[model samples]
Target chain A: EPEVTQTPSHQVTQMGQEVILRCVPISNHLYFYWYRQILGQKVEFLVSFYNNEISEKSEIFDDQFSVERPDGSNFTLKIRSTKLEDSAMYFCASSESISGRARDEQFFGPGTRLTVL
Target chain B: EDQVTQSPEALRLQEGESSSLNCSYTVSGLRGLFWYRQDPGKGPEFLFTLYSAGEEKEKERLKATLTKKESFLHITAPKPEDSATYLCAVQEADSWGKLQFGAGTQVVVTP
Candidate 1:
């Protein structure tokens, strides 16, 4: 089966530095998302992207966070200024369809472990 | 705020033993409830989606049931291969397709 793929399985960055997490969602999928899970915490939604635009975002997705679909397959999340709290497992996901109030299940990537020091 | 809480953070079951995991959630205009399985160091693998109260879906030894306030994943006669962390998530009508996930329940099935 086709699956979502993310680059840089793990990353270590200095506080206040910038980092970009890249993902390649399933080729035919339309919607994409980013989520993070702090150690021993629930998975928290960060943002959703569709039609090359942000559809929704959470408080955690503040000024320092940005997402881009630079190409047909590459979706990326950039953190302008990493903080200690930014260290977590960031997952990328995509959905094949969603329309007319129907919900389409999302497929998740293995996730990138971001470590800020 | 949307919230999801799962019960029995961890569980251990002998081969052939059956049990259930619970997920309780609060969200406005719930669009769907989802169940996923995760192995260590891996991302969630989608299992099922429950769209309404009283809805149920099943695959292999797993059965997922949903209600207005909670969801249950029942494992019947499980085997060692069933050992994994089970995650439950919810999508609200206004979330724009973002998922709110619970702290998963880890299950260990010993053969």
Candidate 2:
């Protein structure tokens, strides 16, 4: 089965540095998303992209955060000037479409663990 | 605001034990209720998606049931391999592709 793959399984960066978490979603998926989970918290939605443009974003996806397809197969999340609170597991997901009944489930990548020092 | 609350934050069970995890949510016109399992250091693995009250779906020893206000995931004769954090999420009518997730229920099944 085709699955979403993320790069840099784990990353440690300085508080003021920029880090990019990359993901290659399933080959044919059209909808992409980014989500984050703190050490012991619920997974929170960050943003969603379709047609190479952002469709929706959460308040947590503030000015410091941005996402881009970058290429046909890659989706990336870049956080600028990371803060201590930015440490978490960032997940990328993709879905072929959202029109099917019980068939449009999102497929998630293994996740990238981002640690800000 | 939409909210999802899961009960019994953590649970421990012996091999072959059967139990259930609860997920309650408050959303406007629920589009779908989803169940996922996650191991440490990994993303959530989809288990089931319920679209309406009285709907049910099953896979091997796990069974999922949904109602208007809550959902339940029942595990029958569970094994150590089933030990994982089970998460519940909801998609409201107005939200497309965005899921409001619960904190999750951690299950530890010992041999």
Candidate 3:
């Protein structure tokens, strides 16, 4: 089955450095999202992208965070300056449709583990 | 504010034992409720999605039911391979595709 795939399974970055997490969502899927899970914490929504623009974002998705559909298949999340608290597993998800009776069940990628030192 | 709360942070069961996990959600307008299974260090794998009250879905040995206020994931006669963290997420009707997730229930099944 087709699945969402992310690049650089693990990343090690220093504080104040920039990092870009890339994801190739399932082919033919439109809506995309980024979520993060801190160690021993719940998965927190970061932002959702559709039509090449952000649909909604959480408070944690502040000025430092940005998402781009740089290409047809590539969706990326960029953090301008990483912090120690930014260390977490970032997941990329996509869904086919968002309206009607077809519940938009998202499929997740393996996730990219970001470690900030 | 949307919130998803899961009960019984952890559970241990012998092979073939059956149990249920709870996820209570508080959202302005419920669009959908989803169940996902996550292994250590891995992203969540989709299991089931419940759209409205009185809706239920089943897959293999797992069954998920939804009510007005909460949802339940019932694992029946589970095996050791069923061990994983079960995550529950909710989407609000007007929130587009953003999902609010719970802390998850970690289940460990032993042979």
Candidate 4:
């Protein structure tokens, strides 16, 4: 079974530094997403990307956050300046289809644990 | 805005005990509801997907059922290895691919 994979399973960064979380979604998948879960909190949606463009984003995905599909297989999320609150487990997901109205299943990666100090 | 709520933040059961976890959602034009299990420091493993009311799916010791407003994940004769955090999420109405998730139900089974 093909699965989504992420790099830098764990990361530690300074409060004002920048960091990039990378993911290589299933090769044939067309839609990608980023979600975060704070300790003891719900998994929160950050953004969705399709056709190399952002489809939707949440309030938490503000000026400091950006996503890019630099190549065919890699999807990345960048944080311009890390904050204490930015520390969390970030998951990368992808679905093989892109029909908005139909039910599509997403495959998730193991996730990257980000720690900001 | 779409929202998902899960009941019983934590649950404990004996090796042969049976129990059910609930997930409630508030969203327009429901698309799909999903159930996943996550172990410590690992990604969520897909369990089931319910697309409409009266839909159900099962695997091993777990069964998932869905309605218009809520869903239930039933575990039968669960074992210690079944212990994990079970999360439920809903794909938003007209959403391209984003998913709104619940706080999850943590289940612990002891032998």
Better of 1 and 3 by lDDT: 3
Residue-level lDDT for B57 in candidate 4: 91
Candidate 4 yields a Cα-based lDDT of: 0.92
Model 1 regions lying over 4 Å from their true place: A100-103
Best candidate, DockQ-wise? 3
lDDT of 1 by residue, B1-111 (tens): 449999899999999999999999988788888899989878899999888899899999999998899999999999999999999998887677888898899999998
Candidate 4: deviation at residue A75, Å? 0.6
Alpha-carbon lDDT, every model = 0.92, 0.92, 0.94, 0.92
**Chain A only TM-scores, each candidate in turn:** 0.96, 0.97, 0.97, 0.95
Residue-by-residue lDDT tens digits, candidate 1, A1-117: 899999899999999999999999999899999999887777889999999899999999999999999988899999999999999999999997655234489999999999999
Candidate 3 Cα misplacement greater than 4 A, ranges: none
Per-prediction DockQ comes to 0.73, 0.70, 0.83, 0.67
What is the TM-score of each predicted model, taking all chains together?
0.95, 0.97, 0.98, 0.96
TM-score of only chain B in every candidate structure: 0.97, 0.97, 0.97, 0.97
Q: What is the Cα-based TM-score of model 2?
A: 0.97
Candidate 4 has a DockQ of 0.67
Candidate 2: regions farther than 4 A off: none
True contacts kept of 4: 0.71
What pairs collide in candidate 3? none
Model 2: how far is B108 from its true place, Å? 1.0
Give fnat (model 3).
0.84
